[model samples]
Target chain A: MTYCVAIRVDAGLVLAADTRTSAAFDDIRTHTKLSTFEYPGERVFALLSAGNLGTTQNVLARIARDADTPGATASLRSAADLFEAADYLGRALVEAQQKANGAAADGVNLEATLIFAGQIGTGATGLFLVYPQGNWIAASPETPFLQSGELKYGKPILDRILRPETSLEDAARCALVSMDAAIRSNLSVGPPIDLALIRDGDLRLSHRLRLGQDSPFYVEFRETWSTELAAAVRGLPPFEWEAPRAPPAP
Target chain B: MTYCVAIRVDAGLVLAADTRTSAAFDDIRTHTKLSTFEYPGERVFALLSAGNLGTTQNVLARIARDADTPGATASLRSAADLFEAADYLGRALVEAQQKANGAAADGVNLEATLIFAGQIGTGATGLFLVYPQGNWIAASPETPFLQSGELKYGKPILDRILRPETSLEDAARCALVSMDAAIRSNLSVGPPIDLALIRDGDLRLSHRLRLGQDSPFYVEFRETWSTELAAAVRGLPPFEWEAPRAPPAP
Candidate 1:
């Protein structure tokens, strides 16, 4: 299981993904689920993936290999815009699935979802949720955030706090808080997070960071949030008992 | 879809359930999912259910119908203790499934889960998560809470705050806050809510209240919690940029 969240805020876009993957209780591993496709001055596309690690890795590898080949099928660098880049990536995923489908018939569930977002040339910064079927939906003003894997646990905070006008910094903080809530509640989603920030007009990645368990900022945020929540609950008025019985018989 | 949560605290037990049911987007309805069986000072049991509404209603009606039949299948009143009562309820669920399973094959998805907790004749106050199979597991000191239906959204707050030593009033408040979080995040789970509290060794029903969207206490808690969370986030130290960026070329 994994948890990845991305927000398209007024200031920019914030993307965060955890690095833990497990097939069962005994087989747990850490693998980076965030991959980047950047052409320094022209475009920078970030992909946050969840679901079958094998399928995602294969699809990503194929895209990279194709990009390295001279005059190969549409690569992120050659795509006219972010939308075309997303389309190329989606096709890459489909090709990978077709290659693995024969073996997947024997009980293996090969499914993967990717959140593809970034800036391209001077066109509008795009954020899309690419489906397993090679289809995608771009985030709009009404719904300015996208999440994949173990999303339900962290969705409440986002639903309540996220908006199109939210600042990038605030959105980043909320993303971490949401992830903290999910990690505390679920064992499947563990530490070592990958985060990337892309500003609206910037053709290059603005801020990218990896967060581990000992990351000072994350630790402080978790502890302070928990403390504040407890304090908040305590501050609420205690229920007023309308009827009181005599002291319990000794 | 529904959301129900119950917690066992040192002071007593707290149970809360939503009252919304929907077959799809357009076929939503309101129905109470809480059932109470009381014999005054002798015994009291509150059952909070989630899953298929028809199945749960049938199980409840069956238990009530068999309460006075001698030599009939075991019922809540006929059980020897709280554990036995939970088992009997589980069996009742299985019975309901058997009666409705035929319809299920034709497309109906008949499933139900119940959280049963109460006191019986000065015995230990107990809480159990009764499954659709009629089997159940009692809550313990290690894990003093149980939730059913749309549980993930509300689980984080409960995990962070609930403990065996939490006070009854605090536990009730926590339950409401948790449910509020779930309701905000999930469209399927909504209000009005039913809450029941049972104090240790009292052997009788303590407090049961129904809360709606306009319920004063709920409204206050929701508003206060949101404000407190925003304040807490704002209080956190702002992320320090290691280096200032150069002004973009005009």
Candidate 2:
């Protein structure tokens, strides 16, 4: 399993994914689950994927191939808006799964879920979680985010902290914290984590980072969070039966 | 479905469970999932349950009936130690499930998972997760907690905060915070939350709390956590690209 999340705040979009993939406990591998397509100042789209690795790679290849072909009618570059871009991704996902399942053994699953997040021309910045069925849902000011794969373990922080009014930096930090929860509690969702930031209207990537398990910056981030959280828990109010503290010195 | 967790620390044991139970989304009901049997100063045991409510109730009834009958030979009251108590509960659970499943239509499931936690006279205080198969595992110093049902969402905090050396109050608070995470992120695991704590040498109950969604103490606990967590996230060190700040004014 994998864990990926995309947050759409007013300032920009934050997309993140964990890189671990496994067929069995003994057969684990690291693969990038994040990909980007940018036409600097015209359109920029990031894809965060989860599920069957083969199907995800096939879908990504199709998207890239169509964008490169001159006469290809529907591609990320040709799509008028983010919704159209998501539609193309959904169709590609469905087609890839169908083709892969055709030659697979019975009971094997080849489904994939991809998240499309970026800006297109003058349209508002957006995020969409494209389903395995080729259907999708867009993030709005009210929702402001989308997630796929081993998601529940990391979701409470996102639910509590994200909002349209939140700063781009804060939203990005929230995504990392959310992923940290998943990575710590679950074995299937490991790192190096991939993170991308696309500021609204820039129509280009602002920052892209890969944080391995030993990255100093990432290690500091985790340690700081742990220390702060321990302090926070320590400061919680004492129970009713515990003796009340005297008022603070004047 | 339900969510229940039992934490065993050197200080004693902290046991908690959410009260929401449902056969379908529309068929929700409230039922206590924490049960306690104490022969004050001699022995004490608490049962935290998940899975089929009918089977759980049947097993509890059997335990009660056997304990009340003089010379029934095998009941919570008759068990020699914490492990023996767990064994009695496990056998009762299997018996209950087999009887329920035999009378039900095909495809029906009545399996339950139970955690037996307490101490017997002059022995070590203990916690055991009794399986549907009548086997069990104890919570040791290294991995000091056991959780059942919709457990993943609430697990990260437990991993971060629990230990044998953690104080009884801190461990109890950690259990509440863990329950808070599950209650916020999930529909199936919810309030009112039931909590019970037993001190290492005291055979009788230490504290028993039932926190409803609207309970003032629970509301305060949730709010405090939310506030502290938000502050903690705010205190995280900024990324490299952010402009460096000047020293604080004296």
Query: Model 2 TM-score?
Result: 0.97
Model 2 segments more than 4 A misplaced = A245-250, B244-250
- Model 1, position A135, has a per-residue lDDT of 85
True contacts kept of 2: 0.62
Candidate lDDT values, in order:
0.84, 0.90
The alpha-carbon deviation from the true structure for residue A221 of candidate 1, after best TM-score superposition, in angstroms, is 3.0
Model 2 chain B poorest 10 in a row by lDDT: B241-250
Q: After the best TM-score superposition of candidate 2, give how far the Cα of residue B158 lies from its true spot, in angstroms.
A: 0.4
- Interface DockQ of candidate 1: 0.50
Docking class of 1: medium
TM-score of chain B of each: 0.90, 0.95
Q: How close is candidate 1 to the true structure, as a TM-score?
A: 0.88
List the pairs of residues colliding in candidate 2: none
TM-scores of the models, in the given order? Answer: 0.88, 0.97
